[model samples]
Target chain A: MAIKHQQPDLVPLFIRYVGAVSSKLSRIHGIAGRDLEIKLGNDGVIVQIGINAEYSHKVVPDGERWTSEWGVTYEGMRGISQPVDHPLKEPDVSGYIWPDPHKPERMAEIKQAMARYHSDYAVMVDLSCTFLEAGYAHLRGMEKFMMDLHLSRDFACQVLDGLNTYYTALGVHAIEQGIDIIRIGDDIAGQNGMLVPPKLWRELVKPRMESMIHAFRKANPNIIVKYHSCGDFSAIIPDLIDLGVDFIGTMQPCGQQVDMAAIKAKYGDKLAFLGGLDTQQLLPNGSPEEVREAVKDVLRSYAPGGGYVFMPGHYVNLDVPLENVWALLSAVHDYRRYPLNFD
Target chain B: MEISTQDGERSMAEIMKSGTLEKLAQAVLEGAAEDAKRLTEKALSESLPPNTVLVEGLSAGMTVVGGLFRRNEMFIPEVLLSARAMRFGMEVLRPLLAETGAKPVGKVILGTVAGDLHDIGKDIVHMMLEGAGFQVFNLGINVEAHKFIEAFQEHKAPVIALSALLSTTMPQQKAVIEAFEKAGLRGEVKILIGGAPVTQEYADKIGADGFAPDAASAVLKAKELLGIS
Candidate 1:
């Protein structure tokens, strides 16, 4: 099991499922889709197919609309184009919006494709990448997406609400499929505290997201809901806990003001924590002992309560050393325990 | 908590310089606003100069709280409540200090840079700077580069801080800096940058005088950049 049950000798190795990559599959699972690339333009329709389906047209059912042979042209796609409110923007129509799972054959095709990317230790689910962020990226472009949330809040809210609805539905379906943890990853903060004022966030995004979380909890109490927002969100721990989040994901130590010891001390009983390693500076820049020392300090603080799981702060960046990854995993597997102490 | 004064009849200044003032500071840092007001009133009744009450009592208290902020010992809400207590104390002193021309320790211009609309960080910076005795001119969010230059000229601020939470809006920092340069006011003022993607290295690369990862460091950087030591 990914989560530790008894006093085990080592931590269970677990890999978080990142979203589907359109790139080449390493032959672990057979390629299911003929056209592999999924692309969204300024228009509304999204086009996804196996590598061979690039030239072929297939009719698919999208939410309320039947989109046949999803168009590649800018105009053929139609959802909120060019982000609703900001200038200097374009909109992405092609973020992960679940295709109609009601259609058995279509759902089967997607499942087959997802199976190609599945792992034994991890269930594939990065639920944090929402259609709203994509819409903002399309409207304002990726560069100003964060700022536009501040500049054009109403529009941001509109996009976020739509994305939240989509995500909640997808999460429910994924849960029914026996996924253990839903990896909801979003960069609400980069290296500082927060991108949007907490007030603004509470006004627009928080209420809807919180509702979704509440609904998820009511649906399945045991399925862990893991959330990741980078940087210093020390102000919002109470809010996250109140919203029924089961696990806090990607606890970056370098950016933001999250002190692992303090957070563990404060919220360990209510929420499990994952990913406290300093992937930004340490994993990419530091040596083996540095990784071990940092890991030890985190273990001392967080592992004592038995609610902590280990992973890098975010994705193990492509630049991170495989040795560093091994060292980090080794320390967790070897040293982490309920009575963890490092005097 | 009632604060005990030194000996029996020490001067208000002396009492302020001792543990009595630190106690009042602790009250504010803990967000004990009622105790903060009562203790501050006692200091004033004891004939503490309003400025001394601020510098020694409130500012000193806030400085300790701000230290917790910088060390990650305290979070934003904790710092914010303390700042609120400091503001209440300042309100008690502002009118009296006006007679002394005890101009704010310095003047700072703060805003969410052009295209960026987030202001929690900017607001916290404003509160901290005001508590630290610098007058702050907040430009709200999505402030254009020209507005900053205009505020600088108007406020004659010695330091200008730019905030951007988005990588896209980060370029606005450069535009604001260029605005200062265009008005022949670049060297006359210090420029500081902060936000999610902003780094000390990026701040230096962009020609900002300093970069702070959080609001507490912003104050420390403010004092350092202005050579206020």
Candidate 2:
């Protein structure tokens, strides 16, 4: 309903927690896994099943390194795995072996989540680190990948094509399984602006994404397409909307995104927003009272006439206090109602 | 043609009129590495001093790149290309600069804090500092506090720049500062901190001497910290 620009009973919540924060909350609730997410008041559950899962969601032990199916190596640090080595040293992808995305085991988690939570909650299938991020962060290192975009354009396109082919099949399969949202993302932006020039992103990444979204929509036209990036990607929001994205997320409050009121006013009619709360300072460093007030302020700014989902700009990392988490949740409940009244 | 103009006002005018150094600067501004390298070779073959080639050709181009970057006219990729072009020219000049005992503007140490593997920002700062004529000892990503101190001891660089991309790893910046404090060397050097999540407030909280938002400002801040005009 929010995506349709109608106010639901309350603003839907879709908060994500990092491994440590989730474990900490779970310990307090005496429950683990999905129940803990429910206890924390998440209106949705995300089952990430691609490079994003291996690179981000998988927890490895400290001081240990593991290589993923794509041959990228990651090191464990503070409850998250960081890619330490990329597979593609040079631009050539001819000898590279992509992990089979058609494997049946890949859909197991999504199937279980569908069975368990499909009736009551939104089930999103995250295929992020999907294109540019996978190219830069997983296959080729940032410097090499970025340089390749300029120096080795065809090779870069080959890598992106390989990713598009793999993920399009995987996403279509997920859509056939009737998932609520198909989340595709990349960290193509920094705090200030697009990491790649807008023209370059349009030339290299946009078409692949358009084809992927086309495949996804062909599978299920009703499936919600949510585009996510960590930082200010307002430059490409219109492009995303043109490509049929119904929702956009993690609208980090930085750069052009600092003025949430202006963004809401401009794109509210065409796009629904998720994740405007600041995670950098407020969630980690602010007082619980401050957190609540900020949450109310976010709701007041974004929740008018619907088209908003309440979430922190990024995953709640270990730095965030438990009290702030509680405050974020309670304040959402207090101010998330239709016709939000802060008074 | 033997050009013997190596003094002050007439020298710059003669060099500009010759267009060799100007072409080198334009090549860097355009990020044409081969052109930069070729022009650098030409300038050297013309019996131009390595310092003259560096200051007049490469550094002059980088100054324009930095200004354009600050004004948001050029983005990171373009800046990086320019940095790459500057490096190509430097590769030919470094040994010659050393032979002439031409000192860098100053020495500085740069690194991403411990547990932070993100180095794109730090790498940009590295090249920008080098482009600005600082001898930068870039301790690569996931650098521990001890490693930074060790590098500081070896290089005796008066300024250290630390980068942390994650809020999880951001505390390591404070940890690094604390390590320097414990080493009793905190007073000896100025520390500058930056990254995606870093701010002036965090820099102040962590006892950092300065904070920079991006690579261009980092150069200005490093110069300010070093009292380099």
Candidate 3:
């Protein structure tokens, strides 16, 4: 309903299930990952394209850090490998191996997913770590890249150009494959504010994102664009709106004066929001009843007339008690029905 | 690290004035490290107190930077620039301050927890603490609980700061605290934790002394824990 911008029977629920929680659910239900998501009552499914696939490569020869096809290195520690070293850290960032975005077999899994659950669930392709994240975070190392943006705009633009060239074409391909939404981003902000200044973000990241979204639209024309950054990228929400971002999500509730009601009133007509539950505090510490109330409160904020999808801010990690997960979905099932009468 | 062109124009008498110090603070606030270095040298050359140059010029600028950072006026790269300026200013004053036998506000032992290689947040806090006049011993990333305790013993730091960006590695925080508890030093040093997934409520539940949501607040909490006020 919200994704289509029409009134639906109930608010939609989406979950970006990570490995541990998925494994836990899989064990409890004796089902595969996709089957478990269906059984858990998710209305949508994320089809990850580049990350952790066969060509993506998870392990390294050193057994410490794995280098991706793009030459980004990741140190294995947690649920997902965190990017540690960037291959393009030198002054001359050229001549490094860029991952082939046009891999013919890449979309095979996405096609399989579409053949399986496309009719039932809203399929969103996560092409994350897209521009700033792909460029600064994994490819160029965050600190050095951010410093270089101010110190060496030419180098910074070169990195951004490289990312834009790959992701824009890749995003267009995803849209052409009939994916419902294209999720593209990097962690451009911290808990407090923008990672760099918003000015810098607009100067560097915004244009690249605009170009990517443009390419995505040129392919599908009606495809919804969901921009994903973990922290407070709310400052760039307007820029996202201008660039035709339909859904904004996995919102980290910290340090910003996030007026949800005001956001809904202002951009609600243009943009739908997904992911509002505070996974950091409320999910990890709050009781089941608290989780239920949080769900209702979030629904009240985002699920009014329409244009809101239910999800936690980030992955439901181990810090969150299993019961709370049950409560989260249960609350979504109970109060998320249309006419949303929460007495 | 570009020095302001105006630095050469200031006379010795004017360099000793509060106006000169204010400009130095402004330079640090703007993250002008070279300008900060030149001003520190000029202030010293003008026979100003080394402590005054550090406190009034550099530290005062960092105080404003921290405040701006908290208020969301300054972001990461901006903060890094200001920190670089503060560090450059400190580089000028360290030798003189060592001769004067001036002490830091307190000592903080810091690390990213075991199995978590994330260090950007920890690095920011380390820089902020050092800028705020605290002696910090950073133990780097993927550090175990026993390693934290070992560092605490070696440094005799008043505060131990732990960070974990991953939920899988957050248990390492609890383990480190438990190790401190077993060592009978849990009460001796204040334990403060922060990261992406960490919460103040979680900190309270885990018996941590405090929780900082960001680096600026971490510095303030470190001071508050050590009774620096």
Candidate 4:
């Protein structure tokens, strides 16, 4: 209902924690994973599939190095795996073998999550690092990939085409399975602005994304398309709307995104927002009272029109204190009640 | 001998009048690597000083790029291409510059600090610094404090730039500063820190010499720190 721009009993909530933070919370609450998410108050359950699931999110001991199915080597650090070695060292993808997307094991977790949580909660199939990020952060190194985009346009197109083909097939299958939302996440922006120029993104990544979205929509017209990027991608918000993105998230409140009320007022009619809380400074360093006040501020800014979901700008990393986490939850409970009362 | 010297001076004057150096600058500004290299070769063939080609041609072009970047008229990709053009010119002039003992504008030791693996921003800073004539020893990512100290001990570069992309890894900047202080080398160098989550306030808090928000400003900050005009 909130996604459709209508008021609900309360504003929808979907808070995510990194693996380390989740373990820390689990130790205290004696619960883990989806149950802990529900206990902490999340209206949705995210089941990440594909490369992000198989590699990036998988936690290992700090400094331990391993290679993914795609042959990208990563070193585990601070609960997240950072890609250390890219498989495609050069622009040529002809010699590279893409990981099989049709493997039955890829959908195992998605199936289990659907069977368990689909009845009560909104299930989101997260296909993050989907395009540009997959190319830069995983397949090819950042510098080489960026230069390829400029100096070797055809080779860059070949790389994006490979990713589009792989993810489109996987996403279509997930849509056919009746997931409520298909989140296509790419970190194509930085804290300042879009990492790639808006024109270049439109020329290269946008059409491929449109085709992926078109395929998914064809599979299930009712499926909501959510877009996620870590930084200030406000320049492409209108483009995302044109591409049929129903929800956008992690509105990181930096650069031009500092004004949450303005953002809500501008795009509230067309797009629902999932995150606006400042996780970098406020959540990690702010007092519990400050956390609560900020939560109320976010609720007041975004929850009034019913096109908002409450979450931090990014995952609640280990840096965030346990008290801040509780304060966030408690404040959301206090202020999330609809009909808009911040007085 | 006097006649040959006079004749060489006349030809050099004619070359300058014909705007060969201006063409090299334009090539770099346009990010046309082939044109930059060809123009550089033409300047060298005409017996222009290597430093003349570097300062008036390549660095002059980069100076404009830096200004446009600061004013938001240009962005990362365009600046990167400009940097690439500058590098192609530099590649042709490097051995000659070395043989002549022509010093860089300054020396810089740079890297992403310990526990921070992100290097795209740092790499951009590296290119911009080089375009400005700094001989930079980039130590790559996840560099420990001791490694920075070791590189400083070897290179004796007067400036050190640190980058940290995550708030969690930002403390490592302070650790590097403290490491220098402990090694009694704190007074010997200026430390300029930057990255996504970095700010002037944070730099002051961490006892850094300066802070720049972006790569373009990073070049300006380094020049300011080294007292380079």
Please give, for residues B115-137, the per-residue lDDT of candidate 2 as tens digits. Answer: 88898889988988888889999
Residue-level lDDT tens digits of model 3 in A46-108: 777663343232433323676677776777654456677778768466686667889878888
What is the lDDT for B104 in model 4?
92
Q: State interface RMSD in Å for all models.
A: 10.3, 1.4, 2.1, 1.7
Please, what is the TM-score per model? 0.53, 0.97, 0.91, 0.95
Off by over 4 Å in 2: B1-13, B16-18
- In model 4, the clashing pairs are none
Instruction: Kindly report the fnat of each predicted structure, to 2 decimals.
Output: 0.05, 0.45, 0.57, 0.35
> For candidate 2, lDDT tens digit of each residue in A101-185?
8999899999999999999998999999999999888889888888788889899999999999999999998988889999998
* Candidate 1, residue B97: how far the Cα is off, in Å: 1.5
Q: List, residue by residue over B14-95, the lDDT tens digit for candidate 3.
A: 5465666888899999989899999999888877778778878888898888888878888777787888888898898999
Using DockQ as the yardstick, the better of models 3 and 4 is 4
Q: Score residue A200 of candidate 2 by CA lDDT.
A: 87
Candidate 2: TM-score of chain A is: 0.98
**Residue B175 displacement (Å), model 1:** 1.1
* Model 3 TM-score, 2 decimals: 0.91
TM-score of 4: 0.95
Docking class of 4: medium
Runs with alpha carbons beyond 4 Å of true place in candidate 3: A51-63, A256-259, B1-20, B166-169
The list of candidate 4 runs beyond 4 A from truth reads: B1-18, B71-73
